[model samples]
Target chain A: MIRILIFCLSLLCCHHLVARKPEPEHIQIQPVFGTENLKLNTYYLLNNHTDSILIETLRFYISGIEFFSRGECVYKEKNSFHLVDLAKPQSLNISLAGLAGLEYDQLTFNLGIDSTTNVSGAMGGELDPSTGMYWTWQSGYINFKLEGHYHSGATKMQQFVYHLGGYAYPFAGIQQVKLPCKPNQNHILILALDYLLQADFSAIHPNIMSPGAEAVQMAKMVAAQFSLKE
Target chain B: MIHVPLKLAVICFGLAACRSNSSSFEKPAEWPEPVYDFSKNPLSTEKTTLGRALFYDPILSADNTISCASCHSPYNAFTHGDHNVSHGIGDSTGTRNSPPLMNLAWHTSFMWNGAINHLDMQALAPINHPDEMGENTAHVLQKLNASNFYRQLFYNAFGDSTATGENLLKAIAQFMVSLVSANSKYDQVKRNQASFTAQEQNGYALFTQHCNKCHTEPLFSNFRFENNGLPIDSSFNDYGRMQITQDPQDSLKFKVPTLRNIEFSFPYMHDGRFKTISEVLNHYTSGIKESSTLSPLLLNPMVLSSNEKVDLLAFLLTLSDREFLFNPAFAYPKELFLPAPKD
Candidate 1:
């Protein structure tokens, strides 16, 4: 009886020793607009991030989330929403709860608001109007909002609303953004407002208030401003 | 948290939900089936009660001044009586008049121009518009969350105590849906419980031929966008559905409003341009704008003489349901409020 009791105690101890400790995750974010990977500032770093250890400000909305590694797509939530607004940006603290120390070479997310959410009721977190994604009227939320200072006739000006959205045609709001990971290290994405200035100004329409055909066309014009490092 | 005795937590959570102690609202037997889709959100007394409370509460406005009931009073078939243009927060008036809101289940679209696509999104227009309530949903939710009454009501309407935009819109829609009106004299005439006078019968026949194509029987509106030609107002120059669609072909078309209780619902048209039914009839008779968008039915004029106009007015008067207008269930809940609302 004594030997049996001693054996049971040893077995319990061995089981605990084998319990695995949670480790940091490897995550790769890819922004896809239509059929292409969306890159920003010649580097596919994190595009729209709420909180990040790598950067002070990374603002954007993740329209769609796609997780995959080794050609096998693992996690895909069509409506997994993520908005990285400066007003309510989440403090980026890496955790193993979702993506940690896992081989993920492929991931995708949306860069603008979708139709259903645009019509749905009050949303918490990134969707707050403080983020400036909300339109006062007639319908739908602004998918992509960017503000920055630039030289207009030689004087630097600020306070611009780069609201882009249009789900119902002739307004389509599909913004594709890509965040490339630096092998083995999380990346930082900085999309300065200079991207709009770089593009042909004639294509961009400022101060959009609803999702319609014009908003979608402007989003595409802005998407043309993005590029990759490698 | 799970391991502790759960009874105390259960009791607290149950109290927080504030489920109604009253029975659910019932419909009259003679009424037709409701147009609201109930499968999405089942009807329960708790939800309607929550909706009614929200409807009456002034916290919905930016400055705590207006509620849904402010413009859509229960006594006027859920409409503002005698207001051509609706008055909103801070005495700011809207361009279009406030229309009656009962029998909403039958409406294909909302507003004078059918701007809102769904019933759930209707309140957003008023709440967010600068000239209207000027309140944002987020702030409204915060105010509601602070109140024990609203939190409990939200909890009861939804399974969770968390007040969300979905629950708020749903609650509002539930109340609007509950504002069903179908017990008028015209309804009884159709059901064979009563018969109309000869003049009224003649007016209804004229309505069937000349107006029924647009204002269909039973519901008294096809809910279509039509250009019943009116000269543009130089001040407002509002071109109803054309603004939303942007198609020149849809230029002057506005949603054909229901003619139910037409006598009380007027002044007619989107802009309240016609203060009397005679003016409206005159426009139909000789004032149709020859735009590409005008309804085909109104291209030719109908010459309704003065006597015929009176007959038509007689028909419209029979559409009012005093019982629905005076329903105590829809009245202010005296039991809940500390002080009754002032007239």
Candidate 2:
């Protein structure tokens, strides 16, 4: 009788050990201008290395991360909203505590906040309005912002600013990104600005402060520039 | 076993305390559920008190010369009385007239153009506009953090001494939502505690026939965007809703202004174009400018005789809730602004 009780206690201990939570997995986002690391306020070559451009600010939101295996969602991050700023290094690394031991072949995330969260009232943490990502003139978040100057000629600089976001119908700017990934690996997602800069800078309007067809088009172009670093 | 009932009693007492705290924001008997999700920012007496103080404080402005109440004075039905367009810091004038503040919890969108989609984000427009408060929200938070009085107020309201933009906006919203103007004569009549005069009764009939579709009963607004045909002011040239939606069909379209407290909330129209209630009536009867996006209901001109206009005006007066305009709670919180208690 005593041997049977001991056997039951050992089984319970094994179950407890098996159910222990695993350590969190990390995903690092690296922003680059072609092969070089992107730096704010620093001049970089663009448009086939013919024009000099300086990026003063570059910030965008990444949210609603989900991991899928064989077309089934294996893990999803709760309240997954992150604001990645070129000026802030620590913010680029996202820790997914839920992704531990998950054998997922696909990673998915929204390039901007979902429409539901945009309509919802004041939120805290990284989604806070004080983060300067929210548009005060209108009730929506600025999903992606890039402001800088382009050198038209020596000593002649033209300022360019882009504030891209809209959650309303007929002009939703949020982009969903799906990428293939290896199982049990820390991922590095690279945002290649060179691809984004390939657009005719002088031809397209340099300023896009409000949401419209141009903002949506630009947001789509920006979303296409993200890729898994090889 | 004895502690179980004791714990249940304690929980019941706690719930009762919470109920008493939110008594300031009571919904009217027949009103629809408020569009604001109260679960996100629950009403509390302390938060409302803090919000009232912030609303009256000029520290929200960059020059410390203007406040929300500067233009939205309580006596004027929370509107800028006699001002065609509201002037802000540095005497800079804004293009649109300041909208009155009442029954905000029922509103799903704000501004004359419906530019703001939520009540919580409405204050940002005036606060950040250069011609208004001319203040950055982050800078405003920093200033609040610097003040000992605000720190205590923040702590009392949110249990955190540090002031954040989220808390600041939420606190202000608490005060605005509490400004319910449900004690008007019309409301009293609706509740069967009072009766309308014969002229008011006739006017109410006419109202139901002509204006009730847009300016609905109870709340006095359908809260939908419509183009009431006022000719474009060449000076301002504001294409109201089209500016936000970027669609030509929305040109000249504006959110239908609530007729509640219309007697005091003039000069009327988005730009305060009409000075008196009669002028507004005249525009409805004769001054509708034709456009492709004109409201289908207004395609046919309204014909109200002069006597009918007077009756309409008299009925409109019944919407004036003096209790709301003179509520001491909504007035300037002089007690809070007094020198902070010595540390």
Candidate 3:
């Protein structure tokens, strides 16, 4: 009878231990282009540019998400790569399950595909080869894709397609980004479309489909355009 | 050191067991860790057999007439030998020569221009090219789904009959990664099991001095894009690496081809310009065209006498691995595709 009682106590203790660890909380990452928080295919005016221009397509990969508390990393999502596509509005919002009760003060992630995955063979999920983000001619993933039209004062509108990608030395496109965050809040990351106005459409039209100086420059600019949506 | 042989015996036994089932990766001696991450797509005999079937099947192509084997035949070291350039569906010729496929597990990039980055993604180009297979993934999936044979094969390989793009590409990669070539005479010499002939030894000395920098030992090729001083073709005007990078400095650079199985893999170079190995040597020795983007190693002319050239060619033959070329395991899946005739 005493032995049975001891077994029951131990079972209850194990259950208590498991109960103390809370379930993970779900956190969402919403992508916004300028002030509109608009859907894809919507045209927006370029801010502070000499000519009026509109952006129609914006897509990129966000990966290596980690959460830190008191400067110590507490939680990191396993296989944290995501493709934030504008054409598919659903892909823009990434819902991450954070550890329960662990205070997350800051968030960090990559704005483009990491070099490791680029060298590794075919992958599925968001990083799948079917995503159309992969360059068929070249082996690496396009870090980000920005396509739009620039309207000159004259009648002809110029189309601009910028595909920024490179994984080798001298031109790695992956950029690290960190931002402060509150737990469980729907923090939206804004991609400042105005920064794109700096591109000289006439001089560098169809810029950077592969690795080079132009690709590295555009990737740096795209990484800089991110800010917490107010 | 006395018990080292026993330890080796145990390891060899373990490796033999692993090879019996095709799901494991074997790291050869002195090779760098493979770039292919097998964790994501673990190899299985079922997956590899299915992939081999897919490689030879006309079902992947639009017209069901052209397969990967059409351009990359197993007999010719996985490269078509009849034509200078690849002939695709409808008898349309491609601009570039089809590269021979082997030792793919180590390659960081694919294609002559280093255009395709991954081996898994390499098939997409030939599959979708208008002159090639001319089929899209959606149509190919539909065709694969319709076939009862493929349905069962997919079920056995991936636990279900659904022909998704992920499983399709992963299965192909499984077969490709298995094409390892480390059984050549040169490899045996490196292992101390064999000795080079006097002629080959002299050739090895010359090769070490002139070629080892670009075509590194063991693997044979450094796999970097370099302009080997080939003058731009006036007709084709193939500015190799520049087309991908769009940088003028990168113009005329092409991925260095491996010299393995050179005896069989003829009509060489990106455009299949050299029909014989002697022609290739002559070009390297005297035919180097001056260019700004030429590889610095080739800036100074190669000073090989006629006798040294013969010796170098003799050494090059040591790279041929008959074990890889004639491996029945890599041959067509005849039992799966064709019905056996009753005696």
Candidate 4:
């Protein structure tokens, strides 16, 4: 009987060992805005521009993350959509834990919520309508929101609020961004808005609450700002 | 060692009981599969009840004066009769008519213009519209968090008292999708439980000939956007689907409104231009304005006589499901909290 009991215990131990799943590797993507240590609502000089601007809010969406190497997909984050808000430091950090032991040369993601989820009604989690990224009157998610004060030539209102978003055809604000990355180590994606400082605010429309040529232009402009940190 | 099998059996039984507690959402065998996936947002009695309460509560509004029920009244088949265009908080006039809410699970898109594609996200439009609720989700959450009644309700539905915006929208959607209207006279006839009258039968034939292409059976909407050639209201200047798609080809196109419960959900059409069913039929027959983007079905004149119109109206009446409109489970939810508002 003792021999039988010992055999059963060994079998149970082996079964436990076989049942264990492999642990996935974790990596973080941090959104560091222009010139690092840039505080919100603080007046700063724009690069080679006469206007001193104060950025109050900068929020945008990043989705459909795909890691690739040698023209083959190494890892693809399932249902990967994230809203990165500059005001909230925690919102800037994204976890790539699902891609454990994956080696990739490049990664690609969209700068706006895809058309499918935008029309798919009230989604839960980050895609929730209550997140303020969603437009109530017009049915679409605002891809990028940039609100700040720009030096106005003569207008009484010096504030500029550009809520750029639209996923429909012709003027679709969905921008695809692909960047090269190191193979083995974890990656941190950086978005530098310094280009906006050089960009003439006088020429750009300030208020873009709906889908139009202006919203599309702003979406493209912000999408071009992403780069991998060294 | 002997008790191990017994423990496993108990766990299995418990899981089975939990699954059984969530009564399966039934889809009528005759109907096509629903567009809304129930697997992601499983239905439970508690969650539905919570959703029903939220639907009736004006607390969702900025001033706590307008609930979803304000525009979508159960008595009127979930649509108001008094307004051509929906009236919102402080009597603010909206641009479009309030569409009736029923059989939404089958719908792939929402709104006359098809601005919203998903039923779950539909509430955000009204909730945040300055003319409607005029409240953001974050503000609504703050109000819900302060209420002891909502705290308990949220805890009962979601297993936590903290009312997140996601949970709030999900609960509302759960209630809206639970509103299934598959027990109309037409449905009864289809199920072999009852037969249509001669007038209704004749009307059904006429409908099949003239309207069934767009107003498909069962759900009564093909759920496609079409320009039915209603002359543009110069004041509102609403371009309909073209506003969203930006393609001039989609000009004046609106999502085909469902014809179910047409008896009560009157003040019909996207802009509520027709008050009576006869007027609507007359418009189709005589008032179809010629347009570049007009639906191909309306390209030729509809030659329906006065008698055929009556027969068609008779058939349309059979689509009204009183059981669905007056189901106590979907009513004001007085048992849950406050009494139903007296209009």
- Model 4: residues with Cα > 4 Å off, grouped in runs: A1-37, A47-49, A64-79, A95-107, A119-121, A153-158, A168-171, A183-189, A200-202, A212-214, B1-20, B338-343
Selected candidate, larger TM-score, 2 vs 4: 2
Steric clash pairs (candidate 2): none
Instruction: Kindly report the docking quality category of candidate 3.
Output: acceptable
Give per-residue CA lDDT, model 2, range A17-95, as digits (tens).
Answer: 9878576787889889878988998888776555788899999999999989999999899889999998999999899
lDDT of 4 by residue, B196-253 (tens): 9999999999999999999998788899999998999998999999887778999999
Per-residue error at B59 for model 1, in Å?
1.7
Q: Which window of ten consecutive residues has the lowest lDDT sum in model 1 chain A? A: A49-58
Residue B213 in model 1: lDDT: 89
TM-score, cand. 1? 0.79
Cα lDDT, model 1, residue B274: 81
| Cα lDDT, all candidates | 0.65, 0.86, 0.78, 0.81
Query: For residues B1-343, could you state the per-residue lDDT of candidate 2 as single tens digits?
Result: 0113433343334433554255445789999989998889988886887788789888898988889999999988899988999999999998889999999999989999888988888778888889999999888898889876677667767878799989998899999999899999999999999999999998898888889999987888999989999999999999999999999999999999898888789989999988999999999999999999999999999999999998888899999999998999999875555433457
Ordered from best to worst DockQ, the candidate numbers read: 2, 4, 3, 1
lDDT of 3 by residue, A106-222 (tens): 878898888878877777778776667777666788888887777766565777788888887778888888888777546677776655655563247455577777788777777
Q: Which scores higher on TM-score, 1 or 4?
A: 4
DockQ, per-model, please? 0.23, 0.73, 0.40, 0.47
- Give the CAPRI rating of model 2: medium
Sorting all predicted structures by TM-score, with the top scorer first, yields 2, 4, 1, 3
